[model samples]
Target: MDKKKVSSWLESELKGYTLKSSQDDFVNFLIKQADKIDKEDHLLLKDLAIDWINSEQKDLTTWGMTIAVEYNIQEATPSIEKLLGKVKEGKLWTLYYLWYIDGFLKRIKEKKE
Candidate 1:
């Protein structure tokens, strides 16, 4: 691999993405970034999946779950299911917010898809 070119390209294309001054620093940074991203991806996917399971007015939650699961977001299912139980117990505004965000996200997904 053209490490220098890849490094330069990454630095140019991604904000805050830069090769460290030292090789050890760069290796450590990459490891730390990968770990951080894994954690963040877990959390975001969890929220999105919960938003799906808690949804009402349509099977939007199911659709959301389908999408998340397709992308291997397993961590989200439990949270989503928990929130769904709460929403089903008559937490009105929670359902509304879920639906609203679902609509917004659906539009975004449609455009991307």
Candidate 2:
């Protein structure tokens, strides 16, 4: 698939979008659709993913992590780590976020190999 086309579609799809499904369901839809696109679109998707992850909404942040993991956006590690640090101690949400970041880092390593 064309990177430009995919990026444009993502931009429009995510605009003013609200979470209406479970996090996993939403993430699955995004990753499955993104998988149809070429890996060369990583830069565009990475930007979108990072932006989403940085959003104030918890759902958006989760979606962002999913996109980052799916696309192997290693460049997002530092930001992910920073967010992890801010998670309140002993919160269950930290574990969930950690799982995503760990998977994302693993994919990055695999890509490097």
Reference-based TM-score of each model: 0.29, 0.56
Residue runs of model 2 more than 4 Å from their true location after superposition: 1-25, 36-40, 89-113
Candidate 1 — what's its lDDT? 0.47
Window of ten residues with lowest summed lDDT in model 1: 6-15
Q: Write the per-residue lDDT of candidate 1 for residues 1-113, one digit (tens) a residue.
A: 23344334333332364665785665455445334434545554445444545654344454444445445555554545454455556664456656644444454445445
Candidates in order have lDDT scores of 0.47, 0.63
Output the lDDT of residue 111, model 1. 44
Q: Give the Cα error of residue 30 in candidate 1, in Å.
A: 31
Model 2 scores a C-alpha lDDT of 0.63
Determine the backbone clash count of candidate 1. Answer: 2
User: What is candidate 1's CA lDDT for residue 4?
Assistant: 43
- Winning candidate number (lDDT): 2
- Estimate the TM-score for candidate 2: 0.56
Q: Which parts of model 1 have CA positions greater than 4 angstroms off?
A: 1-46, 79-113
